[model samples]
Target: MTRQMIIEPAGQAGLTAERVREVVAAHPAVAAHLGAADPGRLIVGGAAVTGRDAAGDAAGRAPFRASVFDPVANRGVELRGTVAAPERAEVAPSAWRPTPGPDELRAAAQILRADPRFPASGDVVVYQPMPPLADLERPDGTTTRRPTLGLYTPGEDVEHRIVAVDTAAGTVDWSPAGVSPAMHPGDCESHLPEPVESLRDRGGPDAVRLRVLDGGTELWNLIVVRPRASAPQNPGDGSGVELREVRHRGRLVFRQAHVPILNVQYEEDGVTFRDWQNQETRFSATGTDPVGWGWRICTRPPRTILERPDNDAGNFQGVAFHDAGGEVRIVSEIAAGWYRYVSEWRLADDGTVRPRFGFAGVRNPRTCMRHRHHVYWRFDFDVEGSDNDVIEQFDEVAPGVLKATPILRETSRRRRGTARFWQVTDAASGRGYRIVPGGHDNTADPYGIADLWFLRRRASELYDGNPDGDNRAMLDRFVDGEDIGRTNVVVWYAGHFRHDQNAPHPHQGHIVGPNLVPVR
Candidate 1:
């Protein structure tokens, strides 16, 4: 009785990066932006493939999109077209400036070093402390985005200084490092890893396509895309390290899984920074390959591991995969202005899935400031296919007693201080997976809206909310109380990390997520 899924795999390969750029460059807006800019200042961000149409039907030729950001002009453009027809690519001006890609970041560092206000140091490392965010508007209604860079001397554990340079206005502002009074013992004093030059240039496979197996029995087939640095200015375009497909033991577990919204709100501070607010200003992965850019396959033992690129000083910074005995892990180190994000996915030999996100900061102005990191992971679970799936909420009502309720309609929920979790099962087969909260998973504040959200699957509703227009969580807007009984269900889980400078790990260098254990 299991209903067959109509949704096509989102991992379908798309156009080549070179072809995507050619298509994007042909658009008038892009051509003009390129023509006016100084050579090499224009950044062409990576392209993402969208496999389905808005109506949820398979697109014969999946469309691919690329973004172009002009640092000097402080403007961005997004172009879209199908792999089969790159010449017909459509283009639109972006409402917000795109995040500075690896190339742009390097260029920004050079600018910072040239300014007289910059500390005279030749051995300093540079990185973006946080993912680039929204535009700073002027009184005249003109908006501009300054490329911000963090500077730190190698091996120094002290707070770092930041430089925000407006390439368009030929102005620069430097903010020296400051430590919060809350800083104390156990607060992380590590600096962000310096950018590796050849890491972005190396190209081999664009994706990690694997059939995870143990002793000749296949556990799952996984296809993952590295986190995208920047996306279009569209509402739901900024998804991170996409889990294109996760099929466990021959049944589709997740048709698509990704964190589209990563919003940060500094508590009480006048300054706020958010990533993926729009399709723009999102952090791109570390590599340069279009399809598999910023992804690496870790080599075992004796060889340095690339999977742990966020390791402290004097550690390996190359590969992004690790063999953890029963599970294979994939990690992507994403650079924001002064902070580094570790986005990881682990597939076990026993059909377990662990998705993790870590927040780490280098020496920077806000390193010790209190803030909340809100990350929303979208799980498009298609148990045993798609249509017959049911959503069940589990709560411990009494000592060792659990109550389960079928979610009949779309709704937003919170943990509410109870041992609460959720399950997605196929009504026909009674097969499913339980989503268990991680130890560090915390409750959301008022700004985070809710901790959990269940909604009917909609191809158009990729992102939970837009971070650009508003800093508060917006996933609640998608819950219109639509029928969700026995149908494709998309589960949204939000992980809240409260960065209190006084607490241990003040830099917020910790990983948080959930475990997906199969219900056999």
Candidate 2:
């Protein structure tokens, strides 16, 4: 295994994104590849951290991954390396065709708009849909699946068709005629403005800390990671709000909380298109800034709450803490293609932690189509500390009775009729949190089988890591039957949501998750 280097300051400042990009561009391999590539068609994005498990060596050198895309040539090269010294850097073997980043998505849109064959007339809005690309059959009858981008018009009614924009070949093609015909005029307006290049920089503080209080009493404190700092190269590491060292009244509750695995699978007629959170397009988590789509501080009565006069840290993606109704809420929005995901966490004064995932659609045809959004959260509970933590599963045996089962080994289970909830407690003190399922937290299908997964904490198992759509919801692979009775444990909770245009909730905007009630 490549010993990952943690980017930190030892005696000097760590490498910045610009410095890493300079080193990568200067590498012999990258330089050679650029020699033959057209400068006009080249798109280079900022370097991003690659690994979460760092060696924390004295050098403070960190692994960085970047990409150079040749839209005209329809090819991309991924460069991974570390800048060890001012004059020395290392580049790993070049990996081909990484998922499209924000830059690539924009480039694909431009390519499609320039093509004479593109049929769009009015304002053409481009989006990176889940499974951003599509399978195309050439005139020779040979089939090829390339990374694709989608385009649509916001207000006007147009015949709905998937415009597969292959950025690599600089080609534009439409999906076969038999698919869904008209696009759904969604409820929410599409505001997917291009990501601000300045805000997407990866060179900044490792994490931002926030403290919540109800006038005088300290409710809780936490460390939240920005999009770039969350390490997008790692599986399940990118694309959501990440919180660490969450404490309630000085008591350690959650070591970490984030959604590393998000699957947005679409079924049009009989054709299935699988999309992942981390894989296709590197969707930037949005904030209420220039785009008006990120976090906000609001009162319990649905009014806007101002930031504390003394707490002028400026919002990181508009994340703010406001104690309303004895509870504090932190919500962040992520624009994945045309779908906007609202990741919210509510921490109550009484010690109840509610993590919610809300699904809303922008102006797109798929918004009215049938689809399933499966979200999985990896919760690292420390209770008081990291050691002596235990997980227990509770089931309703009778109409008014319940049964508790101590899970001794790593395993995967589903929520049936009697299966209720699970709890993670400190074995010594019996202080933990009960994970109660929410009403919208539906069951998993074969593609997403497990409702709950309990496993011993392993850094390698932090995420599924597999971006291939063919392997959907494989969290069960982490269940190797390892003993987890009396050691540090991690809980993987999966929530499934079905969105159909014809349903009562036609808009398909709903929140699904669990409530973490403190147990003393």
Candidate 3:
């Protein structure tokens, strides 16, 4: 599912090197904060931006078009139009910004070099910063003036690195996704759709209309897809890239939702919760800069949903794109509060995406206990469109249950082999997708009952629990009586584990969510 925003000729792309420099020069510290970095990667971006769209081209590279991945190396712009003199551009020091000098850049670069966790196998990139509205702006949401840097550490293997630095606070914090080959974006990309445009031309006369959006959600951030009015290239079988369902001419359209990006759940202490403490999904903060404008930093790019890939299989490696209007900002944060949950969202070239919740700061003034921070995600899906239906699909294991029909047993406390699934299909065309649990299901625990359930969609039925502690009652109420046939539905999937007392805090964190696979 993708949402196409603005499309204009390369020449009328509105962004210029001068304007790009204005944004970068304004945040010279971020530009300088390369983090003990990739000097060569700093100069030429990463090898991935070398414009390797064809076979003869080098490996791991993408077309040098106007993409979020291309901005870090270039001068915050992905060059377009006919005249291609310099393959890329750099933000040369203009009169507008005098604070950032060679010495300052050298100092910032030291930060990366000094970190023990900084990956030696990855390329460090300082991408452009986008206005805060990049994160906060909804369909009718307000615009913002403040911006943040997006630091990317494109690693050699599956998991990469991302660190958010507050220019105003000069404070930097990162997800535990610290450099480690073993840390892969687990089951993240296995479900979502592929970056099909990579297969077909999105330009010239026969381009397909597609949009990949970095949207907001209750507990986690989202990457919503709205490739309206398009259909699978291979319609009869469902085994094909989502191509524009061609009509005659002068009209190119796709369905409203190719797929519902993500819906997350946070379950802990026998109480299931979604979003913030009071269901506050949206966030706002004022930058410390002199102007003091409000900003939504979470919306910035390198919106890479999934982590990297262990195997080089082209289809398996995920895809992600973000628009960083030319200043490099790594992480986005919220302040003036007791706890800071650095919201880091990534979208891969493949459709795999994840919204990591990095919980920091103190919850209490005293002793912390050995408890679990359980997490789950409700992947609301529409296979072909809004009128789609869903069914429960499972393997031969014969799922075990909690006072229910069938129950699937967990292999171990750590291993919950996926024997459960929910298939969402379009009733009209019979085309749909599958929503699978990311890793483990909680059936083994006596308290844990069902891992997945199918329910019709409703505006008021967003959360599994309300203000009261009796959330399970809400679930019972929604399930007691509802139409399960020929209607829209949302698949609620969960994953959890007990956070032991040894769990690192104000230091370490966890990545939790589910996956929505487009079923061919």
Candidate 4:
């Protein structure tokens, strides 16, 4: 009662639909692929048809629902409509009718308005089924169910076994057969280093200390013992050195645990001692990148400072000290290929630190229209007790550049507020950029304007003596161009603010920040 039809390129010479079906039936794989479809259905490379209506003309148009199955992509796209010619001469027997409502009319209007935005036209109606009842299917094509039972107990591991349960009394009890012996804090003098007699004499029992020095540099020094524990455990034998109880004078600064070679000490002249452990410690500093990147760091305690060249392949390249505060800031001229582009840290007065980085900026430069330059610094620190905390503050210092070429223009209706200026496109990558409303003001004072002009003229000197000459080149490039001299870089400002509940239905007078980058 059913028949099969094959579809191929329309212009293929001497190729018949019946012959293609015979070829498909001869191959087992092709037959299996065809059998996977609904019975009495004929399938082509990209389309399928069911020959159920024998009386209907093969070319006659009919309205029937089509559900396309894409096995390779594991997707089903359903299209509802009758097959008809461009002139709609015939109607199909499978057509179904549904009552329309005002909501459907409005939805149709919205769809019509959005149709112009895309290149092609076809009513795409999607049907999404509810999730399956079972997440996994068993070998027998049924779902495996879980057991509903109380807590399970394995008898072999039971040390204190439960012999019985009193169901009526609603209670169960067990007893331990034995208890493990407690550990004692015995004499721990084996880890002590040989005590220096001369240093102990100068600082007394309360001042006996140890310090770590790196390459003759005093990193950290702290009191190791007090008078209360100063009594030598073995006395004259110099075996178990001990100190008495007394208040220690200096602070204990540990080196980074990862870098064992880096030591810490305190020094006045050139002499240093090994007193403190070279363990992880945190500090702060501030410095500009060799190529003009800016950075700042703030900490509660002093920190160890380390610096390398801008060409060094790491997160940190330079360092600076922010007065007496534990602030170490560094900036790198070139951005790292693997490191994050930018990060902002919110430092609270109560020692709580919140960090937010540029998560959206990690784009591959080959495909991305934007390029990011970043600078970063690191600190090492040590604190007493297990709960050491540091608060860090971060800010955006420089805005990156964006380039685009002009596209369309709006000339008339200027007073109606729909006019726009020049639109530019990037020559290298055909991405478009717009030059919206932007300007600069210098109305503070005549002398102030003069000073600003002079500073702008001599901005190259601000490069100072950084290792990267690229900083000077950037300054020169900014000053030499006419557009750079007159044009103001786009500034994007965004923040959260409170609004009143009684605001107008369509609020006006508030300008939301510009959408500079596309968010995926």
Instruction: Point to the candidate with the largest TM-score.
Output: 1
Q: Hey, what RMSD does candidate 3 come out at?
A: 20.0
- Candidate 1 lDDT by residue in tens digits, 370-396: 788888888888878888878898888
Q: Sort all candidates by TM-score, best to worst.
A: 1, 2, 3, 4
Q: What's every prediction's RMSD, in angstroms? A: 6.6, 8.0, 20.0, 36.8
Residues 1-520, model 4: lDDT tens digits: 2111111111111112343334333434433332454322332111112222311545644333232222211222323223343121121221111111122223332333343432232322111000101122348663321110011121223211111112212222122111111211121111111111101111111223322233454333322222112111101000011111111112212211110010111121211111111110112333322222112222322122112212112232221112232211111111111111122222221222122112111111110211111111111122221112221111223454333222121111111122222222222332322223212111112111110110111212221222332211112122233322121121111111111223311222111111111011
lDDT of 1 at 392: 90
lDDT of 2 by residue, 49-99 (tens): 434323354464666555565545444556655635533444333323345
**Alpha-carbon lDDT, every model:** 0.62, 0.60, 0.30, 0.20
Ten contiguous residues with the weakest lDDT in model 2? 303-312
Best by lDDT: 1
Q: Is candidate 3 or candidate 4 better by lDDT?
A: 3
C-alpha TM-scores of all predictions: 0.79, 0.74, 0.36, 0.13
Model 1, stretches more than 4 Å misplaced? 1-12, 28-42, 53-66, 80-83, 122-124, 130-140, 153-160, 168-171, 174-188, 192-201, 228-240, 276-319, 417-419, 464-470, 505-509
Please report the TM-score between candidate 1 and the true structure.
0.79
Error of 3 at 262 (Å): 15
Where does candidate 4 stray beyond 4 Å?
Answer: 1-334, 338-340, 343-382, 385-520
Q: How accurate is candidate 4 locally (lDDT)?
A: 0.20
